[model samples]
Target: MLKGKKIVITGASSGLGLMTAMKLVQQGARVAITGRNESKLQAAVQSVPHAGRLSTYVLDVTDAEAAAKTLDRIWREMDGVDVLVNNAGFGYFERFIDAPLEHFEQMMDTNYMGVVRCTKAVLPQMLRRGSGQIVNIASIAGKLGTPKSTGYSASKHALLGFTNALRQEMRGTGIIVSAVNPGPFESPFFQTADPGGTYVSSVQSLMMKPERVADAVVKAIVKRKAEIDLPGWAALGVKLYHLFPRLSDRIAGGMLNKK
Candidate 1:
């Protein structure tokens, strides 16, 4: 479904972004990947099968002006951008009181504002073209909050809201906006969490693989789905929580206490 389409992915150095890039390439998409680490980006391109169709850009999504400049360059080189996957984000799993203010700021800047910056940079062109797809890699935390993940949850929640609003506003524009909220994925996310924060030790076995999430992204883009949550059971659980907040909070509190 992505044949000959120009797609740009952020945080493409490793993990979910890298996996998604490979998947998209295999499906015949021309990919432009961005990361702060040049060596990692080079290595990622080498690892993909159609390395010729993959281009790398060293960019920090937190820098709004720099992100816009980089996007402009990419659009010029790629001819036009057909899809944008906003997957650049990090997490700090610590209690609200224990987490530093800087950590919260970093999470908001990268996870939430990063998406905003990239979307704004590309929206004018997409709107003019009247065809584009935006896939946001949010998390289950965005749907149901957990202890010691206040900032991460908040950032994702913001992304979710933005995606919803964008989708509504672009209803008849032929521009697609969707979000994927996946359960614990077996990516580097946990290991990359702030060193000072307390990480979730339990439910490790329940984590899905990064490839699963990447596959879901491709499906969402192809189908132009409004939103998706991986592992049908996980999606059901999140919905149930939304329906019964008091019960959900009690269960979540218990899980945290047990940990």
Candidate 2:
């Protein structure tokens, strides 16, 4: 479905971003990837089969102005972006009190504001063309908070809210806004979390692979779905938690207490 399309993905150095880039390229999409690590980005490009169809930009999404400029330059070179995957984000598994203010600020900046910056940079072009799609890689934590993930969860929740508001504002415009909330994915995300984070190693055992999450992202883009939550059980859990707050709290409390 993505054949001949130009797609840009952030955080494409590794993990789900890299996986999605590979998949999209395999399906005949010209992919542009951005990452803070230049070497890693180059390595990722080489690892893909049709490396010729890919371009890499070294960017830190937290820097709004830089990201905007880079996006403009990329669009000029690529002729315009047909799909945008805002996949750049970080996670921290620490209690609210123990987590430094800077950590929270960084989380908000990269996870929430990064989306805002990238979306704003691309929106004018998309609106001008009257056709585009944005796929935000949010998390299940965006829907329901879990222990030791206060800042990460808050940032994701804010992102989901922003996506919803933008979707409403873009109504009648040909642009499509969608978010994908995946359950824990087996990636470097957890290992990259705050060093003093609280999540145990066993927790990582249940995570799905990056390829699994990438497939869901491709589906969302192809179908233009409004929102998606992976692992049906996780989606159901979010709804159930909302409906039974007290019980949910107790259950969550028990889970945390075990740690």
Candidate 3:
């Protein structure tokens, strides 16, 4: 379905971003992948199936000016951007009091503002063409504030809100705005979120694989889903939250306690 499409995926160096890029390339999409690390981005270029169809750009989404320039360059080079996957984000697991104020800034900058800047960069073209897709990779954390994720949760919640509002605003514009809210997955996410390696140990076996989430993302784009949650069961918690707030908090707390 992605044949001849030009897609840009931020944070495509490793983990879920890389996997999703690979999946799109295999399906004949021309993918421009961005990352802060040149080495990791190059490695991802080599690992995908259609190497000739892949482009790599060194982009730090936290840098608003740089992100805008890079996105503009990619769009011009590709002639147009058919899809934009805003997947660049990171998180930390820590007690709110222990997490430095800078850490919260990092979360909001990269996770929330990154999406804002990149989306703005692509808007003119998408709006002019009257056709496009913007995919925001959010998390289940956005739905329920899990323990040790105060900053991370807040950023994702903001992203989710942004995605919802953007989708509604573009309702008659022929643009697709969707958010993928995946549960904890077996990716480098935990390694980055819990650099000390203490939290990932307990739920190692339960973590879903990156490929699973990638497949879901691909499917969502094809179907033009407004929002989706991976692992199916994970969506139930979100539903429960709307039905019973206090009970939902207890449920989320219980899951975090296991980690």
Top candidate by TM-score: 3
Tens-digit per-residue lDDT, 47-166, candidate 3: 888789999999999898998899999998999999999999999888897999999999999999999999999987899999999999999889877778899999999999999999
> Model 1 over residues 1-259: C-alpha lDDT tens digits?
7899899999989999999999999989999999999999998988999888899999999999999999999999999999999999999787799888999899999999999999999989999999998999998889878777899999999999999999999999989999999988777777766353234356656768888999998888889888999878778888888899898777766764312
Give me the runs in candidate 2 sitting further than 4 Å from their true place. Answer: 194-200, 256-259
Q: TM-score per candidate, in order? A: 0.95, 0.96, 0.96
lDDT of candidate model 1 versus the reference: 0.89
Candidate 3 TM-score over all chains jointly: 0.96
Candidate 1, RMSD to the unseen true structure: 1.7
Candidate 1 stretches greater than 4 Å from native = 194-201, 256-259
Q: What's the distance in Å from true for residue 196, model 1? A: 9.0
Q: Identify the superior model by TM-score, candidate 2 or candidate 3.
A: 3
lDDT, candidate 1, residue 176? 94
lDDT minimum window of 10 residues, candidate 1:
194-203
Per-residue CA lDDT of candidate 2, range 1-259, in tens? 7899999999889999999999999999999999999999999988999998999999899998899999999999999999999999998787788889999999999999999999999999999999999999999989988777889999999999999999998899999999999987777786767354345454656568788899999999999999999888889889988899899888776663311
Candidate ranking under lDDT, highest first, comes to 3, 2, 1
